[model samples]
Target chain A: MAGEPVATSAAPVQPGAVLLRPPTNPVDRRAVGWWTVNLLIGFAVPVVVLVVLGLLITPARFWLFTPAVVIAFAGLAAVLALPRWWFRVHRWEVTDTAVYTRTGRFWQEWRVAPLSRIQTVDTRRGPLEQRFGLATVVVTTASAKGAVTMPGLARDVAEEIAERLTVTTQAIPGDAT
Target chain B: MNGDWRRLDKRAVPVAAVTMVGVAFLAGVPSAIGLSGISVGVALAWVLPGAVVVIAAGAGAAWLDWRFTRYQVGAERVEVRSGVLIRNRRSLQRDRIRTVDVTADPLQRVFGVVTVRIGTGEHSKGGTVQLRPVARATGDELRRVLLARVSTSVPADGRLATFDLGWIRYAPLSFLAPALGAAAVGGLFNVADWFGRVEGLVGWAIDLLAGLGLIGAIAVLVAVTLLIGTIGALGFWIEMWWAYRLDREAGGTLRVRRGLFTTRSISVEEERLRGVDVVEALGTRLAGAARVDAVATGLPTTVEDNKADQRTLLPAVPRALADRVAADVLREEVSPTAAVVLSPHPIAARGRRVRWALATVLAGELPLIVLGVLLTEVLLHVAWITAALALPIALVLAVDAYRSLGHGRVGGYLVTRSGTIRRSTVALQRRGIIGWTVRQSAFQRRAGLATVWATTAAGAGAYAIRDVGAETGLAAADAAVPGLLTPFLAPLPDSRPVTDETVAESTAAGEA
Candidate 1:
């Protein structure tokens, strides 16, 4: 809400002695709905191919369908459940000094990129994400891992984060030069 | 100041001719032996004449190549003009120069000549220029001139270290010795098979061993293989490191000059160095020896460049001596990594390694177990034997891996040690670390542990302080590169501001 620059400012004070500030904003809720549809379509093509092959190549080995069906259903269940769980666990916070990401449910990873090391900040919108009015912010660093992507944000919010990150990174002095 | 255009040493032509003839003979002899109807004497009658022609042609080509290639050393840049058909002219700026490496193979060594490679540190194509078969003194002079800032005498006293004959003992201890021996054996077998001599050779070997018992035959086979491996390893070590010397030139360049047959003189400018890595292979570690590699930008990371000895600061030496060499290179009293008492990682890390090791060993046994239950009793005995051997080995390795995980700071550098098989202790500059990645799996979260990676532009790019307490990992990372991770962290319930004092205290307490 405040237009004051966070760059060069001290870290946001600890809220009730908590060491880390929880993710400041939630992504667009429609992200889960769009992801579920996308995953189902992605999984369906492979499952269909396997079923057709099983019937055509070895009709006597029809029992192959049992494991295939079980696996396909298991994968579908995970895909269906993951987006919602991801939406819940995935959080990002940008400070003057670094950009932080906390993502993955079963495997929680926290990544921090110092502003000085950032090479570029970008906002990407896939067809599926566009349909849901969502976008992803990707940060490129000097390190070989290339870039880190944070998906599931409103298009405008993604643009705003990208712009702010770019400005902050450029403002920092020393290191790369 | 433009210098006169100079050609390669005159002896290169004859050397080239001899090499061509030798190569032709090596190739022709093998095929001559393989040809079913041709006698050795008959084959040589025709092959020798062809070989003479090859030698003559090779000499003629070398002469033309020498005539076409002329290089001029200028005040500001080095200019090389070469190619008969293409007629290309290339110039490298003196200020942009990063390395000047000299190489001399056995033939070149006989003629007292070396090949000089001038590198500008660019990894892209056309970033290096080569001047072949220069007199060894000329190569040295060129190196001195190119490396010098304002033309000062480089003191011979600047030499920090030289090759030790005792270091040869470490040669066979390296994993490469046995691996190379195995490859050599495989290659011999392959060649024999190709020439249809495999059966004959095996039959001979079998006949020789028939006099001995089966157990004696097996023991003799192993002994023979080991003997061959050790000899190969010793020969290789002598060839690669015979005249090894590390020197700090007056102009602040650190250069390595070594080799027996293919002698190499490689140098890296001091400014490019960001840190050093002290690597101890499992066997070398057990022998209390280690090697030092430089962590620097613009030194090639490409696989081919590794064979060129791009980053080796010191070859295998006593761990203490390697540390001293590292410190000498950095101009520090003691290398930061070796000096610090690195904090041990959480017990959860050990638990994780043990679990993974057990699973891996079990997975290997699972196939044998299933096959045994379904079909054969012999396979069941094999499975039992395999499990009995593998499980203990896996446990020991897991414990070694756990013991290797530690991280600490010494002044301006952050030091982390990890790995069991190729254990590395990297002392990287704090300023060089550009980012941090704090990771926690569900299992790690349950145990309140995390792996924090410090990402930099140098070395393997990311070195991790694995599986420490979540808070400790963050604090160490934050302290290493101050004001980097603090702003991004979510406030914790028991949050205390991670100041330098607290970080120092935590490290002193061994991150316990």
Candidate 2:
């Protein structure tokens, strides 16, 4: 007896598929600027402290601490700068069976979660983000602390993603895992 | 229902008047004391100002009583129309009420008057609609009507149970022995002087008592300890008796009625409950009694004021009944959730243990150090050895954290157990999480660790699992909710936008 064709209706979305693009609004640009400003402001305190120490301490001790301070600042700046590039490079695809995210510059990190496992989708905006009309969407899964944040999206885009995710997640059975 | 609602007992008026007078008298006591330390004219000045304010306040209270003393309750609602000139009218809807509390002070009891308070979940200037000094019979009828209305609104599937504390459940004798010993030692310091005062008349009697056989002394000591314990137990029993009723009504409404002089009742809807916490205090743990509290959303904000209301639920219950009662009242499968073990990182847990042990060693050696300084001797050597002894205690604590550090899931719920002397076990469902965060510090990043905090709308803040491996934490978050990582991955389709008319219609429907 011949076996029947395997069902492909619930197959995972293709990794290279582009589901949708974020809204091209001035608000999105402002949100990026606001985050940049916050990062700069946070850096100011350490900079002030180091300057004061350099002025008060001896030259030899100052030189000893200066490299460590510069390294620390550079590390912080790198973490802050990486988000912009990550957002630009990131793309998502969704099908009946799975949701996948592909993001990277030199080395890519691709995460594919079956729609059955999708639990909740939440969107939030701080005061600065609100002023810039941008939102951050967070998707949480079953595993502890298993979440990813997507920022710099317009308000309407965030709402649409929330609706689609809710529908797709609800339609799948055995997704609670 | 149409029967007359009698006014508060007339004698309550006199008792209130006496209380007011006493307050006024006490208000002047400090000024009167100050008067004796100053010149005659200055003393008069100090006394006059306070006396004037007290007199004015008393007169104003009396005027308020004369104008708006009477309050009435009907089958549908309670009305308290009071105020001298402004005429403040407050009406409480009987259907909106969650519980009715009736209390009576010693004087009010004698006068056959009761203070009736009707509590509702309405948010306004008047948190509780209160009518003080109503007649005992009227108070009872009012309570019945309010309870009847509230009971109708509750769903039919809930259960009602009453609990009592017996003498056996009284805390074990071991817990109070230390306190009694301390009290007796302190009492010895005062007894010698008392014996001296009556030396001539009862000198022989006092000597006989002091010279009593060791057995007699032991018997007397045992009697005193038992008496104190009995008194404490009686107080606890009385409180338990007064606040013992629990009502589980249909539609998932759970009502807990409790309190002594000021009876407080709380009604919680089933859908709003987030979790239940079973806490055992160090003393209670020794006695094998654990207190249980059901956690819910929209808990009264007043519960946060630790001083005024420490209880998030009713009084503490025995451990045996905690799980059973939670299941019966909440109608949810109750089990142990996650176990919150202390972080076992050497730098964090072991470091704290080392510090504690060192402090203990220092404490033990402090007296010798002081004596050495005074005697100019070699007790300093002993202090050095005492410091070394702390190492073992640090090692023990670090080992304990490692052994105790474990967590697991029970069915669909999570149970977290932690603490050494005072242990806590919290049980919560997976869907109860309102939100969560995964945070990493520079140090934690280097160590491949992160802190995951899950927030619910239940208590004042969030519940957290700290310093877990970053990969494990991420996995746990995914298990908690899969798609929470990217809520806005795909853009939303354009639709008919929200308008003023739609907003108005929704608001109108919500109000209805």
Candidate 3:
């Protein structure tokens, strides 16, 4: 679609019923490995900067190692359990009518968006995701806050999901708002 | 295709120069006063060179900017180019276009021109292209052509609402009065400080109030500030809403036109309007008045420009009138926010509010109390006195807020009301709710309370029912949009008795 992605008139909506339950499908297990690496890098950078500064400047020694040790402990704990915990928490499922997603580790969030409201569907692959041969599918609705991201799917699976969503969305009418 | 570039209206230079000069005069008052010390001839001689440089630079820059600024609607994208030495170009994809709005201020109206803004409805500033001060006919033609696909020519009735001189009664009731008063005082203090005379001004004020005791002086000061605020608020309201009118155009658009010195006409395509927000600030609520705001998708975001409230359709008026207007805007028999029987949040929500309020007060009090003990007895006294004064007010507000918390639905709308200081009751079309976000923090989980947000592309982006009982939030969300949540919820087929059209209305009919 270019220049003018003409939206057809609003088709009647089939008012479907929804229940409040956790999502059904868990993402690829490779996501766990990806998270572990991603988290380790996130924690290591700050500690590295502190250690370098601590060695270079005598004055920084008073505060550097203490923070470095704390970060190290936190990083160690995160690297060990966070991946598995997130893998268990992050789940999603796409149906003919809507998309259901559960994200966030501690403060749980459950989101459900009807397909009629979906504006766009695309697959994103960062370098890290490419390294793991995994891709993430991003679905955006008209609402600024209504973007759902499901990470850690096999690259091919992510592409298929995005393709299916886009096809389904195109058939529905209105501005997908 | 790359089309021929178009320059902004030449009048843009005069507009920019006038505004810049006004700002310069306001900012240069202190320097102007300092210049008074010198003889007029000497001051003129000293200021001539600097003034010449500044005026020339400012005029030359404005002219160059106006000359360089160009906008074009190409085959696939709309682009704008501007700037002098630091040239900049921005473009928005045509396919991504979500809104094309035309607005004309009094200045532009005088020149028979308007501002055309095209956007992708994204939150980022770059998602939009603003073509300021284009010919009025061109702006209208652009809006018509850009949105031609969706236009439906339904012969509209006359105005939905018109400005009444009586509405000014509610003007003084706006909470902006006290806030504006305080802001004025703050400005005065800043101005005094600029002259290094803040202490002297404070001394003079103290001297003036010496006749009264400490409590009397404070009461007098507060009363005076509120009085000033009321006048300022009234003047501002009149200036902003002097000739307000809400109308539905023949081309399936709901248009709002208002403002005195600076007039604005903002139109929302009826198709994009998902709902209405009925706002009643504490003052207005107590006075039995409310304002109506259109909850339409793709309106310009206010975060980038703190200036126009493009969503407001009606100013503070009688609640009944606001409801009537809300109904008219939605094409409903009666507003859902009015007809629905709202279910109040659990009593625990009340307790939570009280606890949060007192906790906040204690946080401030404890720090002061500790500092006072370490520093002086006077501070300790002041801390306890402040706590004593604040506690009851906080508790009352918390209780009122708890009472205000409610959610309900009527017809095809989900009506939810929350907030105390600015209580807003929103009647969002059930179909407009494209998504749901259910959140439960650990403490909220313990309380069996959850916050459910009906996320849509309209007004606030998401309207939330806060601190509702867990089942209440779930049932509301589930009932609001039937099948989407079924797989996630436990198999409670009869969770809620078949209410409304949930099961019966399997037909695919869009909005009424």
User: What is candidate 3's lDDT per residue for B385-452, written digit by digit as tens?
Assistant: 99999999999999999999999988898999999999999999998888888886656655656789
TM match of model 2 to true structure: 0.53
lDDT winner between candidates 1 and 3: 3
lDDT of 2 by residue, B1-512 (tens): 44244344455556666666677667655556556566767766776776667666765665566456556567676666766777877777665565455666656666677777666533244546666677778777776666654335555663455656552354433344456555654565445444443455346544655766777866775676666655665554465346467776554556666656545445565555667766665556556666667665534444322311323444445666666665565454543532223233213333444555567666788998998888866887766676577567655654554343333455445455445444566665666654444454444443444455655445433455555544444445555554544342331122321111222232233244
lDDT of all predictions, in order shown?
0.78, 0.54, 0.80
Q: Output the number of the lDDT-best candidate.
A: 3
Docking class of 3: acceptable
Model 1: how far residue B500 lies from native, Å: 24
TM-score of chain A of each: 0.76, 0.59, 0.85
A1-177 per-residue lDDT for model 2 (tens digits):
012112221344223111222222222444556667566656666666666677778776667467648956785776578547555655555455555454443433334455555678888888877777788767766533355556666777877877888888878774353
Q: What is the DockQ of candidate 1?
A: 0.27
Deviating ranges (above 4 Å) for candidate 3: A1-19, B1-7, B27-29, B35-42, B69-127, B135-152, B193-199, B492-512
Error in Å for residue A146 of model 2: 20
Task: Give TM-score, chain B, model 3.
Answer: 0.87
